[model samples]
Target chain A: MAVATQDTAIRTGRFARALIYLVLLLFVLFYMLPLYVMLVNSVKPLSEITGGGMMALPQVWTLEPWAKAWSTAQIGVQPTGLRPYFWNSISMVVPAVAISTVLGALNGYVLTKWRFRGDTILFGLMLFACFIPFQIVLIPMAAVLGFLGLSGSTAGLVLVHVVYGVGFSTLYFRNYYAVFPTELVRAAQIDGAGFFQIFWRILVPSSGPIAVVCIIWQFTNIWNDFLFGASFASGDGAPMTVALNNLVQSSTGVKEYNVHFAGAILAALPTLLVYIVAGRYFVRGLMAGSVKG
Target chain B: MAANATPDFRTRLQTWLPKLVLSPSLAMVLVFVYGFIGFTVYVSFTNSRILPFVGPDGQPTHDLIGFTNYAKLFSLSHWEISLTNMAIFAGLYIVICTLIGLILAILLDQKIRGEGFLRPLYLYPMALSFIVTGTAWKWFLDPGIGLENIMQTWGWESFSFDWIKNRDFAIYTIVLAAVWQTSGFVMAMFLAGLRGIDNEILKAAQMDGASNWNLYRRIIIPQLRPAFLSAFVILAHLAIKTFDLVIAMTGGGPGRATELPATFMYSYTFSRNQMGIGASSAVIMLMTIAAIMIPYLYAELREKK
Candidate 1:
């Protein structure tokens, strides 16, 4: 009787474990469902997509949709495709990301290594800035941009992003440097090294990991930003997101679902590539931002 | 000897250098962040409309109209619909994300196989922007060419899944898409919290013959309060700032069925040319975000103190 009861307990435990696995797999399917739909639909031609079915893989796959999405898709009266806007995003994001990360690093160095009075309060204020809904600042920001003669300019968008992105990058680097070793700075000080000198030689050499985290975070945020892009930039200055939205929204001719899907994927590819390559740092950045806050 | 000597000019520069390097960021925050907020609040109370009226002297001007914009915002049916939709979206997003995330975290905590693959799979959506998520879901949810059409083709003959088009069900589609993008992030948080829990405590509970359910319910779950709170605050802010998703997916759509406050604010301020009303609505969003953020910030910062 004892043996039989133990046997049943083991079997039940196996069954329960199997149930957990099944549920997890189900969720994985559900999460991947939309992506799968996107991939399959993007490859199939418009004929197969409309005449056949949504889920069926194309009997003959084609990259035409991607080509169209990249070069021929129209938005409003402009048919310049997403290529120019893609470059616009690139130009806008690169400067913004580089500037923001540099500022964040410098800010982090000061906030952590050289503690001053009211620093924490100042940090608290910056963190508060990070979460304020951008809506509150939109109208005034437009006014400021116009006042500065930068309305609808890419350079203006870059300035806006860098300003807002500083809070996050600072938060990231500060948290990182808070736990960083301070003995290096002291030793450098003993060697008669100044602030920027010590930072360039000692701190920056070891900032590889955190810098990776900062750059990736800043890149993703600035690249994927639609609110600022939509509000601040337009016409020749519109980023890929705004252009993509206009493309999807404007349907003067036959609705090209294939091109739409391809465009969506193209827009997503940059951040996706970052996540794939350096996901560990990405998660680290996220946890630091979320958990610490 | 050097320490005892009078401080040199270079040393004094060192003392002030950090402040100088930090001043630019601080000043930017002051002018762009707080100053803009002040300006917005001022705009919210004015009679500014499509454009700020210019006075006879040629400078732009507006009469101080106390709470008139706010009153107009509250009375508008579109604003009311946006608020109602936000309430629904936020409520559902928080509750559903918490539950699903908790479950996924617990399941992953069991030391399952292929966690490496599954964790990233769960997290990849977070890498995509709301525009991508919205468009992807729009394709998958479109009645003619999406899941319903595919389902009908699969010989079910009656597999109806047209929530994206239905007015009563459209808001839920936003919930579904938002949850898909963020639940993985919530799961990651809970998973971290789970990992932080003391394993010896669990061992002790097991030694006391506690069931698995009791172990989670009585001990593990309580310890996850911080994670829960963080998730709630983050998700609440995301829900409040949910413009891109709504705009990308439904465009406040099929006649304001899925209108959110962020979308409402944008359309009113820029598109609909109701800048004052939009600014008022924007102020309301700020308050909502502040309601959740201020206390959370206080608690976190205070804990350090």
Candidate 2:
């Protein structure tokens, strides 16, 4: 009787475990459904889509949509495709990410190691700046860009991103360095090392992980930004997101769903690539960004 | 004595160097964030519309007209619709994301197999831009050449899922797309929270013959309060700042059914040239965000010290 009861309990436990796995699998399907749909239909001809075969595998796979989206699609009366705008985003994101990360490293260095009166308060102010709605600054920012003669320019977008992005980067580095040992800095200082030397030789060498996190976060943000792009840049200077929006939303077109999907995937490729390559850091960045030190 | 003087000077420079390095960022924040906010606030109080009111001296002017723009903003039907849509969208989005996040986090914590593969699959959407997510879903949800068509072709005749086109239900489609994009992020947050929980307590509860349901309800769920709070604040803010997705998916369309404050502010300020009213609307958004953010930041900072 004891053995039979134990056997029955084991059987029930297996049944429950199966149920759990089934539910998890269902969610996996739900999550993958849209991506699968996009990938499948993006390769098919327009007829397959309009013929109610959206969920079906492509009868004829072709790279034509991808090619067209890259170099020949009409966006806002320009048949320049997403090629220029892709470069626009690249130009904007690279400098923005680089400058913001460096500034954040310096700010993080000072805020944590070189503690002084009212420094926390100052850091608090910068931190609060990160969360403010951009709508509040849109008018002033537009005016400032125009006054500075950077309106509708990639350089202007870079400046806007760096200004807004420095906060989170600062937060990440500050939190990372807060736990770093100050004794090493003191030793380096006693050995007659200068400020920049100590940073470059001692701190920066060990800052590899946090730097990756900061760079990835900043890259994703500046690359994907649409509001600033739409507000500040226009015409030939629009970034990929804005251009993709125009291509997809153009009311006069034949609703080229395959081309739109291809363009979206192209727009998404950089960040998605980064996420896949360094997803662990991406999650760390996301967690660090949210949960304050 | 000269050598001693050099060391002193070096020490003084070192003390100031950190501040010197920090000053530029400080200046940028002050001017760009705070100063610009001040400028926008002033604009809201002025009579500037389309362009800044110009004085006889051939310069832009700020002729203050107290509360007129705000009064006009409050009286607009478009503004009313945007606010109503925001409340509904935010409420449903937060609740659904939280529920789904908590459930997924708990389930994933059950020592399941293939955990590594499953987690990132859930989170890839967070990595994609809202525009990309919006584009994918817009077509996926379209009645023609989309889910409805596929369902009808699959012999589910009379099937209808045209919420994307219907004004009354269009807002829910936005909610669906949003929740899909963000629920994974919330799940990550809650999962982190779950992982951080003290396993000793869980072990102790299990030793006391607690059922799994009771263990979660009585102990595990309570421990996730901070995660819950963080998720709420983040989701609330994101919901308010939702412009890209709406613009991509619906363009606040079907006659402004999904009009949100962010979109509203953009169209009014940039397109309609209602600069003063737009500034006023932005100020309202800022106030709402501040009300949530200020307290959270204060508590987080205070607790640290």
Candidate 3:
């Protein structure tokens, strides 16, 4: 009777494990479904998608949609496609990410290593900047950008992102450097190393991990940003997201679902690439940003 | 005398260098974030319309009208709809995301095979821009060419999933997409929390002959409070700031069914020529977010101290 009871217990455990795996597999499918649809539909001719074959793999795969989305698709009365806007996004994101990460690293260094009076209050002030809804500052920002002669320009968008992004970058580095041994900094100081020298030589070499975290975080954010891009820049200078939105939402002509999917993929590709390459750092940045650790 | 003077000057420079390095960011934050916030708050109480009334001296002409925009905004039916939609959306989005996230986390925490493969697949959505996710989901949920069509084609002829086009249910579709996007990140958070739990405690509980259900209910879930709180705060804030997804999916359509505060603020300030009213709405959104964030930040920061 004891032997039989053990056998039944083992059987039930196996059943539970199978159930767990099945549920997990279902969720995986659920998550991948949108992506699968986007990819499958983007390549098929417009006929296949409209013919109720969205779920079925295409009988004839073509890259015409991609080619059209890249160079000749209509985006708000302009046939320039998403290519220029893709470059616009690159220019904007590169400068914004670089500037913000450097500033954040410096700010984090000072806040942690060069602690002073009311520093916590100052850090708190910067940290809170990260969370405020951008709507509160829209009107003023528009006016300011106009005054600075930057309205409707990529540079204007870059400045706006940098200003906002510094808060997050600072948080990333401060948390990272907080646990960094201060003794090294002190020793460098004792050995007659100057401020910039100590930072460059002693601290920066070991800051690779946190720097990757900050850069990836900022890169994804500035690249994916639509609000600032839509609000601050327009015309030929609009970023990839804004341009993509225009392409997809433009009401004139037939609803080219294929081109829309291709355009959406083009917009998503850069950040998605960053994420795929550096996902571990990306997750660390997400946790660090959200959980305040 | 020269040596003494040089050393003193260097000391002073070193003392000031860090502040100098920090000053540019501080100045930018001050002028851009705080100063701009102050400017918006002032505008909310003014008679400023499409163009802010700038004086001849190149300053904002503050024709101070106290709370008039606030009154007008609160009285508008459109604003009321937006607020009501926000309440429903944020509530449902938060609750559903948390539940789904917790379940996924718990399931993944069981020593499963292919853990690495499943985790990244779950989280890839977070990497995509909301606009991208919005585009994908917009089509996937469309009735004519999407799920309903596919279902009907697959011989489920009675299937109907038109929530994206329905007036009352359009907002729920936003909630669905949002939960899809961020729930994975929440699961990661909870998994991190679970992994941090001491295994010896689990061993001790098992030694007491506790059932698996009781073990999770009484011990494991209780220790996940921090993860739960973080997920709630993050989701609440994300729900409030939801604009891109709504725009991409519905455009606040079916006659303004999904007009979130973010979208409302955009249309009023940028489109409807109601700067004062728009600023008022924005202030309220900020206040709502602050109510959630301030205490959380205070606790998190103070605990660190």
Off by over 4 Å in 3: A1-12, B1-4, B55-62
**Scoring each candidate complex against the real one, what DockQ results?**
0.47, 0.46, 0.46
- Writing each residue's lDDT as its tens digit, candidate 3 over B17-113 gives 9999999999999989999889899899997886646877899766789999999999999999999999999999899888988999888877777
CAPRI grade of model 3: acceptable
Chain A TM-score values for every predicted structure, listed in order: 0.93, 0.94, 0.95
> Which pairs of residues clash in candidate 3, taking residues 3 or more apart in a chain or in different chains?
none
Give the winner by DockQ: 1 or 3. Answer: 1
- lDDT, candidate 1, at B201: 79
State the displacement of the C-alpha of residue A171, model 1, in Å, after optimal TM-score superposition. 0.6
Q: Give the TM-score of each candidate.
A: 0.95, 0.96, 0.97
Q: Ten-residue segment with the worst summed lDDT in candidate 3 chain B?
A: B47-56
Q: What is the DockQ ranking, best to worst?
A: 1, 2, 3
lDDT of 3 at B104: 91
Q: Comparing chain B with the reference, what is the TM-score for each candidate?
A: 0.95, 0.95, 0.96
Over the stretch A8-94, how does candidate 3's per-residue lDDT look in tens digits?
Answer: 111127888899899999999999998888888889999888877899999999999999999999985679889999999999999
Query: What value of lDDT does candidate 3 attain over all alpha carbons?
Result: 0.89
Poorest lDDT segment (10 consecutive residues) of candidate 3 chain A: A1-10
Ranking by lDDT: 2, 3, 1
Fnat across every predicted model, in order? 0.71, 0.69, 0.67
Clashes of each: 0, 0, 0
